[model samples]
Target chain A: MLSKKAQYAFRALAHLVEHYDSGPVLIAEIAKKKRIPLKFLESILLELKKNNILESKKGKGGGYFLKKDPSQTYIATVIRIVDGPISLLPCVSLYFYQRCKNCNEKHCGLHDIMKSVRDATLNILEKRTLKDLI
Target chain B: MLSKKAQYAFRALAHLVEHYDSGPVLIAEIAKKKRIPLKFLESILLELKKNNILESKKGKGGGYFLKKDPSQTYIATVIRIVDGPISLLPCVSLYFYQRCKNCNEKHCGLHDIMKSVRDATLNILEKRTLKDLI
Candidate 1:
């Protein structure tokens, strides 16, 4: 259900949680551990850092680490930072909801079905903290 | 989340369900009605037909029809026909799972988390039938 970017981002965040007390994790190391492409992981980390889900450094021992404890980070928060809205349809999205242009009724069957999918997916993503992923 | 192919297929199938008692729906007509690219939808219906979720007619007045009543056609069945598998991670996949290469234990943390996601997503998609989409 997660996007490729979101999957990679969650995996990388997990690695940091597993090693958070040690120090920041190098993007390359996280990529290797997670089996994600180096280039793709780099951009994901940058986005995570930008959103403050993660923080980074630039020195010899520098890399990326969580801005908060693993328990403090929700998987949904990290996912949205990397993949935008998680809802399959833009109109059913909590962050970007706008009724679909062709929806014939306020509770159109199509929209209702999509909304069920969205709500079910979000309930799982939002309840679990990054601590659970680790 | 729905794949692009699954999204197109669902729209096409909904069109078919909407006009089932009528003659076959032209690919172009369904595409236009649903706002999907004609060519992309052509392939989706082909795949759906291969899986027997849909049946097609080759000559004039022939398009596609559900293999069974719309209520018998689960959204999950159509989605699986159009998309390889829905689970995000390979290990948690019901159809293609073979533990992650790096997972240390049978009930490893990562798999457990992904399993929860898969289970939750499947529960919603599997419950809704194509009848709901129509």
Candidate 2:
């Protein structure tokens, strides 16, 4: 359901959530904790900061911190921000719906089956926030 | 939730299921019908047969056939055989239960959330047989 990017992003964010509202969270610390590449994590945090999921400062005593407590940030939100959709197949996806190449959108035989999968996926991913993971 | 190999395997199998009980299913036919590469599908089918989901014969008038109906074969089985586990995270995985690197395996905090996701994914995938997709 999630991509490598989304997985990496969630792992990083969960680390932030663990230290939520206390102080700035360092990119290096998160990268080391999550086994993510430092440069790659730097970019991921920048994107999260852009999306207001995290707030950051560049100087000493300055690092990224959650804009909200981890409990408030849903895993679905992180996934959508990082991966565009919780479902890889657009035909079954709610957040990123698209027609299958050779099928009718309204009466697709695949619609029901795929929808069930999509809903199940969302049900699990949507309920869990960063707090749940940590 | 799905790997590239699983997705491709499912696609190829669905194509085979479509033509079930009709005649011998050519590897090329299933590959082309499903838009999968011929060579990659060859290996996928071989594995499927190794699991007895399919039966094959070499030479002319021989290709492949479902050992049983596509409806009898669960997507979960295919996935497990091909990709080991549906869950990417080891903490909540059903088939491949490895301990998380930083957590106590017995009472891991990540367990419930990951389990829910795993269950949801499995519920959807398990209900879907190749016949459903076809």
By lDDT, who's the top model here? 1
Tens-place lDDT per residue, model 2, B1-134, is: 34567767767776677778788889988877777788988998899999989999899989988888888888778878987867747667777877666555565445566677778777777887878765
How well does candidate 1 reproduce the true complex, by DockQ?
0.50
lDDT, candidate 2, at A56: 93
For model 2, residues A1-134, the per-residue Cα lDDT tens digits are 34567667877776787787679978998888889989998999999889878899888988899998777778778877887866646777776776667455575434566677677777777777788876
**Which 10 successive residues of model 2 chain B have the least lDDT summed?**
B102-111
TM-scores of the candidates in the order shown: 0.84, 0.81
lDDT of 1 by residue, A43-122 (tens): 98888888888898898999998889888888778777776777767668898665656556475666687787778777
Off by over 4 Å in 1: A1-5, A25-41, A58-62, A96-99, B105-107
Model 1: per-residue Cα lDDT over B1-134, one tens digit each? 56667767777788888897887788989889989888988888888888889888888877888888888888767767767777767878887665656565464665676677778778877888888985
In model 1, the Cα lDDT at residue B8 comes to: 72
